[model samples]
Target: MSFEFEKELRVTETNIPGLLVFDLPVHGDNRGWFKENWQRAKMTALGLPDFGPVQNNISFNATKGVTRGIHAEPWDKYISIAAGSIFGAWVDLRPGESFGQVFTTRLDPSRAIYVPRGVGNSFQALEDGTVYTYLVNAHWSLEQKRTYTFVNLADPELDIRWPIPLEESERSEADLHHPMLRDAKPMAPKRTLVTGCNGQLGRAIRQYAEAHGLEGFEYTDIDEFDFSDPNAYDKYDWSLYGTIINAAEYSTELCDDTDNADKAWRVNAQGPALLARVAAEHHIVLVHVSSDAAYGMNKESKTIAPVSLYGQTKAAGDIAVANAPEHYVLRFDAETLQDSEQCAKEVFRLLDEHTAYGIRDFS
Candidate 1:
């Protein structure tokens, strides 16, 4: 028997963003066949995300008509068949324009698919002992499992044509009871939350995000997310955001009175402390621009002196923000900080560098 497979590996994009299909090279001889199921170096060079897979799982289906899944988990997955063959189906269940997009294909040893987080994955075994193997970037747990978004495999609107009728296919009771596409809750993608949107830095970040065609960002000011108000924490879903850029701060003239100092402390120090606490609990990345007060100060002075009440409060806020494990405390001199546009560019450039947690000076 003459069997043929692709001589080189290649990838194809699907309707869903980040979802990719790979055609692998399979070597065959009389003794059977062998294939490089996953070559990280080569795959990464071919547009594949270097998704640091920490867990690997395998499922064996004993019957030809067995079916499983249609689950959109929180972590990305790279799936392929190790033995036999299967029919695969994927759906974009992430919140956005392509929420209901679907893609279907067949997979053998020579075929693989990269399923981005928030994309549902399912398959039917076309042969007995069909082995489905996948690598996930995150370790699985019961708590994480509850976050999975699921859709019924038999949803008529999805119109997935299963070779074997669902009635004849074996499936878990849970899989059979999933909500339809219309009723299913779309998985929330990691979002960028820009606080103090009306401020110079916040406004700049918003404009930068827009001009650069960045998506999944939400801008908010004191009206929506007053970090100074403890009750404000209850108003928003913090889990939806992966990054929070804090540009909110108290700006007031030098004052010696108790009332003014109290107000400054609450807005500058306490507010950031609260935000940092929440961010730390959620493992969210925090980007805070510490006092831009370097306005007209003598640049030659190397001493760390905060003479004004406002300056002291801003310093306290910076210290509080540094408590978060994943944080970027950015400090800019007067010129750059005042130029919101340039400051925004510098901020984004630092973010693109993926710098570790620490203070960054763009002075």
Candidate 2:
């Protein structure tokens, strides 16, 4: 029902926010040591999300140098060691200030770690017959999960270190083919067409991407892309941009006007549809940045039902993106919208079919 980890648990905050460590006080006698791993009322009083563990998992590694992990779930987790030790590593996937940052710790029988949602996690066993247990608030979904079993610990971009050398660490088939973080980004295009380049959002994106090593982005302006034009798709060589970020939009306020409604439908709706088609034709993945306004004021709806005309057009665009063969529609709230840096990082993660996108929903 509840876990009281406060009294016996020592909490430590790492560089990454929300990722915490819990150290258990062990009382040892002539026989052995004893510790309480879970306490309900204690943890709840600390104002933390009452982590009602829905699943309990245990992994036993038979020999030393055995490794398992780089996996994360949709819910937060509490991991404890039953025997031996492990080098556990996790990356925050949430789209805020700490996005894409990694944290690593040695977890033994006396320690546990709390992993937040939207994070990439993994670990390695240091000794044979090493066992660890997990208390998670969510269930496992093979189709919709993003945990990697074999990650390149030697990847320069990740810069993660293991107890053993990179060559000594065992790896799985999936890890061997995984792309490096530096090479994993989709914006690595030789030719990228960035719409709305002159606008604030566009300028911010351009600045952030350039600073973050996103090369080959051919930032295009309103002067270039006339999506309403029937020949718009023919004007450019779409092959180079294997990934397209459709950042252009006809603002919601403009769409409210009757005179501008047609402009809105053509640019906001038809424009995105055309982009998706072009991307599909070229076998490229289209990323359409839509407005969360499409959900209207209700953010928890399972379907789109917007009271505003602007939301309606954005929804049309989102639908088009969703219908495309390969695409991702990103709906961002205006007020809480992340800065361009976060957006750039997210775009990179989205492109890496091995990282966040790698977690699929087979079920």
Candidate 3:
């Protein structure tokens, strides 16, 4: 195996302190092959601190439309493709600093992306034979991890040239002609909020909105708010805002442990409940972000199945929000915001097949 960073995934600067990337070698013959995807000793040799992984996740996708990530948490992760291949992308989502900047790489059986805590990770399968796996130092927390949709991650002007060319199809045509790719736009203004933040999607939303000026919204981490106290709402004046985005969570742990289950429910379910109520009472639009995990392990189902404890709790939160007339519940899985060029290219591709050949509209 050979190791090289994807030309697009380089970091200009980061407060993350340290990030290490290594290429694990593969030994193959006519009979079969062997590769050491992760070796703690090897990582340590490469100068990475030996904080071992606590959780391992494997995701398999079929067909090119099978996009599964933009997944991340506050914990450090060692990510590699065990079976097939994928175009892995990483973006720093930590607030009060440089955010929305990306480092992308083609993670095949040959390469990997080492994502530290506070950075966002997502990927698309270059082909059908793709199995994306990751090792997380922190275990699953329904409240801790967050998901965003694909549209949120496209940045046209960023010009992230993948090692492989993206397939063109009607669905992705508009993205191909996005203005940012042709003529990038100035970075959007960052927004600042004081309460109910810190989860993955929340951080992404905060960073994305600030970077793109989509809605002129800003977010603050949990440290900035004391939602545990009912009186917390009384301290902030809410009249100036047009929308309230709630991404805060109390737990992300998913297991049979009753304590873990209860905590996940309380934080993921109850916390959002309180925030939605406040937003409703204040007459602000509550954009309560949610996840597909609520559907459980039945990936085969056409719809989500809330099976696990985490799923059950998130489902409960979904139900609560559904009951709230003033709230707009947005359910997303693996989201990103791309620059204009990528956006335009995607758009152009989508419309090209429908229009007459040799005639350019340019409108």
Candidate 4:
């Protein structure tokens, strides 16, 4: 059978953020047709994120009208057809304004879609021998499977007009049992990890997050998450966080030339550097506080010229934290602050309002 031959490779933005539809070029001749299912460099250049894929998964449908999903998995996926066609339906299941928004389209060997981590994906086989393949950034594990968010495929709220009626289509019993859109909880966004919860700033941030009913934030102190220890980083799943706020620091004034200087360096400089490295590896955003002292007595100074031990260590930490691929080195005057609560509010406000990376002078 002859199919439409080579078209320019392109991508279309769907209603959902980060969800993209791709048009692939297929070259067909007398023998058969061939296509490059995924060309990373070209796709990334076309606004697709360079999400490092670690696993490839495929699903096969033996008969027409077979159907699956409405599942929101924890990992991003680039899905395409290897053979035949499918009627694909996607629903945004992430928290915020787009929740429950739906987009539906038909996919053939010439088309594909990028499903962000929290979007619910479902499809119906429009032809027999349908082979659906996807590449994901994370390797699937039983623990990860437990984090899936699901909604009923036939939920009236979604009101998807399947090419083939779902009643006559093949679906798993588990898929059949999912809750309606109204009843299903929107998948939570990546968690925020707050370090040094015992500290004034940390406590204030914690209180603010709680009072505002912000979910998916884990607050911890040195006892729970000792940044000075490398083993502490290994104990938790780094993928769970989208941001790490490092409030942990040794701000003691008594550390001048004593053994406490080593402790100060470990907590203030080395610890932040280590966290920044981890954040870089996981593609997570790192948020670190830099002292005004790091700039010496000249408040207008942008360069680091510390005159005190505390300032010196903080300057070193600032340099190290800047190494992260995405980071915010927040500099503000603690002495001028009326209260930690006010500082907390501004920190969150800046986080919400700004997408700009690098040093953010809150002062």
lDDT of 4 by residue, 1-363 (tens): 124569899999989988999999999887888999999999988978777787999999999999999899988899999888999999999877889999999888899999988999999998889999999977787867778999999999999999888889999989999999999988876778999889888999999999999888898888887897887888877776678988887874644767689888888898998998898887678888767878887768587888888888888999999888778887777573337787787779867875321222322
lDDT of 2 by residue, 1-363 (tens): 112322455578788777778777666656766677766676545434455576899988887776654544455677888778888887665544565588998987778887765566677888778898988764666532433222345567677888876567776656556555444422112345677677656777788778878656777765687765668677775543456777788886677687888888887788888887886565456777777888887788746877788889888888887766667777777763446556655656665552232122110
The true-versus-predicted C-alpha distance at residue 109 of model 1, in Å, is 0.5
For residues 58-175, what per-residue lDDT tens digits would candidate 1 score against the true structure? 9999989999989999878899888889999999998778889999999988899999889999999999999999998767767567678999999999999999899999999899
What's each prediction's TM-score? 0.62, 0.47, 0.41, 0.91
**Residue pairs clashing, model 4:** none
lDDT of 4 at 273: 89
Off by over 4 Å in 1: 1-3, 191-241, 244-363
Task: Write the candidate numbers in order of decreasing lDDT.
Answer: 4, 1, 2, 3
- Clash tally, candidates in order: 0, 18, 55, 0
> On residues 1-363, what C-alpha lDDT tens digit does candidate 3 reach at each position?
233322222222233334445566666666656677787775665655454576899877766645433433556677887766777666555442445466766767766667765565657777766788888765565534332112223554445555444443112443344332223232222222424446554555545545654444556655656554466667665433335556655444444577677567666687677666765554444555566667676646735578767667777777766544455554544232113233223322433342221112221
Residue 174 local lDDT, model 4? 91
Predictions in order: lDDT = 0.81, 0.67, 0.53, 0.84
Q: How many backbone clashes does candidate 2 have?
A: 18
- Please report the TM-score between candidate 3 and the true structure: 0.41
On the 0 to 100 scale, the lDDT of residue 196 in model 3 is 47
Model 2 local distance difference test score: 0.67
For model 1, name the residue pairs that clash. none
Give the winner by lDDT: 4
